[model samples]
Target: MALFEQIRVRLPRGARADAALAGGVFVLVAFPEGKLLGHGGDPLPSRVVSWLLVIVVCGALLFRRRYPVAVGWFTVVGTGAYYVLSDVDGPLVLVPIVALYAIAAQGRMQAAIAMAAAMVIGVGAATLTTASDVTGTAVFMLTGWLVAVVALGSGRHGRLAYAEEEARLRATEERLRIARELHDVIGHNISMINVQSGAALHRLKKDPAQAEAALSAIKAGSRDTLQELRATLDVLRRVDEDAPRAPTPGLARVDTLVGSANLAGLAVRIERTGAERALPARVDLAAYRIVQESLTNVARHSGAGHVTIRLAYGDRELTVAVEDDGRMTARPARPGGGSGIAGMTERARALGGELAAGPRPEGGFVVRARLPYGITGERWSGAADDQGPAGG
Candidate 1:
């Protein structure tokens, strides 16, 4: 079956090829031994009529894809007429087999089955002809061949449907990924801006200097937000020739993020260990967003005095951990749905990684993710793990 599928895949998938193939089948079936069916029949008129019927039956097959059921039934009726009239059996079997296959492939299973049964009965009916030499064994062989052709056509139809479904699934996943990117970029930056502007409003009259600083921070954050928005929206700008794209933020910008968090009243410390190595673009982006979302959660939910962000580079993996000395309320989600952590989890799994986010053993919340560097490599310990790196 696999070998047959490979051959079918390699065949030219075009109307021209199908027409040529049908024409070839017609030649072989209509002109056996340089003469039409019943080559030595006493009645030349009957033989000519039989040959014309075979030609007409095979001719309908050229439009099998467009009108499968119509052509299939036409071929079946024409072949039946020829077999009843012609003295010789000829190669009438090929026409109905091809036609039934086309009908079944077009999702007309009932019609194809009915036609196949009719052809079998037609074979039995032809036995009444004095010139027709169709034996019981010959009828059985033709019937079995017809059944196989229907089965093959059904298989081909199923494969085509499966391929289309897979394409739709891919398109859905792409849309979801784009939505996640938009949410992460906009949510994180806007949260910081909201906190800063609120501070500015609260201290505007009492301390103009502090208010001015907060407003300046909001301005900077908004500019960063616009750049990140442009980067996020680039996925939808593939068709735009004039769309300008910005660099995507990665771990290199973690320090910038820490600075922004500090300005938003969260004291965050960054710790880096292990030799840094280049990461794939997806891995880099995932790592950055995970940390960003984690910190945003901390700023919003965690009432911790200080937070620690750790970046660990290992031989086979890279890990990032964000732990805040905050307490979780009864509410299970952030401002929006619980999609923040869910998105981070999806990103890690997409890269063949795992994420852990929960309350720490001590008294705070921790979010840690471990992303592998290569396809075939040992797993590495997460940043919050106490058992050291994997393979150590």
Candidate 2:
């Protein structure tokens, strides 16, 4: 069985070789039978013609793989003609039967079926007219043809189904990858913006100056964040339409970000060191988010009276530390407690960076991040001087 399966898996050389070999074997076997024509009250010339026809019919099998339908028709016609010419049973009939099976297995079902029906009718007509044992021939021809049709159809259907299932799985995996990227990009910025906006609104009336400042900070953060997000999304979208045009916020926006926090009532002070060379897009976005989220946390969780943002740009790395003087005892419970920190950590790790957030030894919360600046040295040169209003 295993040996047969191996042989079945191999590709055929083509119809010509197949036809020649099969015809040669049938001719060699049927050659001696020419004498039976005169002894059995058979027409000697008709029997000789049938033997030659069998040899000719063998060629039909050769073309079966390349043109199964045409081969099947040739086999049916040759076998039918042989049946009318001779009383002898020869290997000629089996050639077309194999062709019929090939048609059912590899050709379209409608074509296979139509050819199969014709084969059945032709074989049945031949068997009834010439063969002595009509009963056995009738049953074998019909049953074998039907079996071939069913087996071939089933195999083709199974292969098509497996291909479709594989395609579906691949598409599902791609969609999941896109979804994860979108969440990481959009979720982090929107959360920080929401937290900061809430803080700004809460402190608005009591300290109008701080409230206006918070509002302004909210506006600027949202505008830049939205622009940055749109730019990132544009990369993912197809190029059928015009690409979205929105500037991304980089390290240069840190001053405006800190100024907004100052206006929101969190007295923010910023210190920068090193030549502010351009950074990679990813690193720039990461640095911006780290500052935004850290300040948001200070405003929302740290009961700090003041916050400080310290940025150090080195040749190979960029570092940011946000420390606040808020009292831990007076800090309100964070909504969805601590998941935000985990999300921030994930964001940092994605860029081969690190984030440290904890209660400071000096009695407040501190968020620090270290981002490698290796390849991202291009300074983002488009920071606008006019800080936008805070988003609602």
Specify the highest-TM-score model's number: 1
Candidate 1 per-residue lDDT over residues 1-392, each given as its tens digit: 99888788555566876688688897888668246433454477766776788778878877887787888889888888876676656787688788888788877899989999998987777676554567889889988898899999899989988999987976776566556766677788888898888878988999999889889989988887776666555546566364333455577778887887887778899888999888765667778889888888877777666899998999878898998887773115765564778888877876688898988888889989998765333221221111110000
lDDT values for all models? 0.75, 0.63
Model 2 lDDT at residue 206? 76
- What TM-score does prediction 2 earn? 0.45
Minimum summed lDDT over a 10-residue window in model 1 is located at: 383-392
Local accuracy of candidate 2 as per-residue lDDT tens digits, 1-392:
99898788554457555766566656654655554554667666766787678767775566666776787788778877776666776555566656666666563677767766776666566567753466766668676867666577658767877888987975675453344334433444455566667766787777676566666666766775676555555555645555334345466767766665565556888888988878876677667767766776666666677888888889888888888888873334345443445655654665667888888776888888888865333222111111111111
> What is the Å distance of residue 120 in model 1 from its true position?
3.5
Q: Looking at candidate 2, what is the lDDT of residue 343?
A: 50
Query: For each candidate, what TM-score against the reference?
Result: 0.74, 0.45
* Candidate closest to the true structure, highest lDDT: 1
Alpha carbon lDDT of residue 258, candidate 2?
67
Candidate 1 TM-score to native: 0.74
